[model samples]
Target: MTHPAAPARRRFLISALSACAVGGLTTSLTACATSTFPFIPDYYTFSQKQVQEAVQRKFPYQRTVSQVFEVALMHPVVGLLPDTNRVSVRLDARLASPFLQQPVNGVFTLSSQLEYDPQSRSVVLRAPNVENVSVDGDAQAYTQQINAAAAVLATQLLTNYPVYTFKPDQLQFAGVTYEPGTITVLTNGIRVQIVEK
Candidate 1:
């Protein structure tokens, strides 16, 4: 009876040891996986910043315009959230056509939502809103309406423009000017030549 009991005790110890070893190995593997990429504190925040910086670098002179445009188009709640992975831009632009006498100033706004997948290193852009509009008008009611419409157009334009990778070559429409092979869009279609460069 004593001999049998001793064998049973030895078997229990062996099983316990094996379980502990397995648990330790799992923990070590988990740690290794998590440690492989520790530089990214918050991926969403980083990506948003990258986008913001890119915009700034793209149009450093238009920083103020970009901020206003973005705010107007983005959903107030979505815009305010931290690390929400979205970017918005607003532009107040003035144009004078050599063909026309009067100069025009317009307000444009755009907003976009971006999602990134860490596993695939893939970035996805959701819907965008764009509002293109004339802000200065004689009638107060008309001015308000135009401004509202501009906001909507800006949202759409912003959302789509980023995805379109709008080089200065793809835009073409009636009343738009392209030089040889390139095309560009002017926000105020009525006031200026949409020149390609």
Candidate 2:
């Protein structure tokens, strides 16, 4: 025969389990609906390799200077200048002209600060300056000419050239529109801060 209190005990246990189950369900639903990951980033990041690849896409660029000398730029080596908040590109340059018996090779170094161009919706090189030009072999006679040509190349070829572009999805998050704000050059790559519109 069952104890006199067994039925009452079973009823109490059932009520307690039901209450616990309901509480657990409520907690689980709330967590699933209202929680977001704490580590989600507000800004987008680009690695050094990605920046290099983006810059590399524009090479090997070629242009004829003064209708006589042909300047072909290739093999870009990109470096981040965190101190000046700029980026540098050292390119291998080949110059050919009828005045020269053979083509002359040199290294052309250029640096520029980055800016967000609203028209282009891109991070572009702005006010590019020719840092240095070093010609190989006996091209001393053409040093001044080469330097001038390098300056032209830096201005004409790279100015307003895009290093990165924000995709449509990248500019939107959680039903909010965000645009790239301050851009910073770091030791390894670039950091673009995004702000809501």
TM-score of each: 0.34, 0.76
- Model 2, 40-119: lDDT tens digits are 23466677788789889999999998787799999999999999999999999998887788898999999999999877
Model 1: residue 59 alpha-carbon error in angstroms: 4.6
The reply for model 1, stretches above 4 Å from the true place, is 1-44, 47-49, 57-86, 95-101, 117-125, 130-134, 137-157, 160-197
- Top of the candidates by TM-score: 2
lDDT, residue 62, model 2: 97
lDDT score for residue 12 of model 1? 70
* Backbone clash pairs in model 1 (N, Cα, C under 3 Å; residues 3+ apart or in different chains), count: 21
Task: List CA RMSD, all candidates.
Answer: 18.8, 11.7
lDDT of each prediction vs. the true structure? 0.37, 0.81
